[model samples]
Target: MLNVALFDKTAKEWREENKDLKGNMRDYASLNELLVLANMESFNAILIEKGLEQKERMIELRKLARNQMLSLEKLNKGNLKQLEDKKK
Candidate 1:
């Protein structure tokens, strides 16, 4: 039985180590999704915990998520600017 807490802790640690993240700290969904991305390091790390692989691939899905978030932020900002422009 894979204890979700272990991964949860790992994800929390990653978040804490990466100070750039802002907002709610409890990101269970993100962590679980990261583990699902076998191409990423998070899956490798989790697998290594069980000696499932000789070499773990650190995929780091969080980085991708962050990139997406940044893109969304930019898009929203651009929209807001357009709204302001329209108002003027």
Candidate 2:
């Protein structure tokens, strides 16, 4: 479910698409993606303890993943720009 929320595909789907790959989709995930997955796992536990339904939890996790990824991308670009400016 978390995989679906973040990557829009399940492990089985990824496997089907990458037959020659050595590992799962997560093995190829970016640093930011790994971070978000960890965070989602934690959040999912809390949501489960709260008795939230699977559908509701999926929606919440998707929103969280999207927002966090967008913020990370913006921050990374800003840092990269700063580094380029410093090299000038």
Which candidate number maximizes lDDT?
2
TM-score of each: 0.37, 0.98
How far in Å is the alpha carbon of 23 misplaced in model 2? 0.9
lDDT of each: 0.49, 0.98
Among all windows of 10 consecutive residues in model 1, the one with the lowest summed lDDT is: 1-10
CA lDDT, candidate 2, residue 59: 97
Which digits, one per residue and each the tens of the lDDT, describe model 2 over residues 1-88?
9999999999999999999999999999999999999999999999999999999999999999999999999999999999999999
Q: Residue 15 lDDT in model 1? A: 74
TM-score of 1: 0.37
Best prediction by TM-score: 2
Candidate 2 — what's its lDDT? 0.98
Point out where model 2 deviates above 4 Å: none
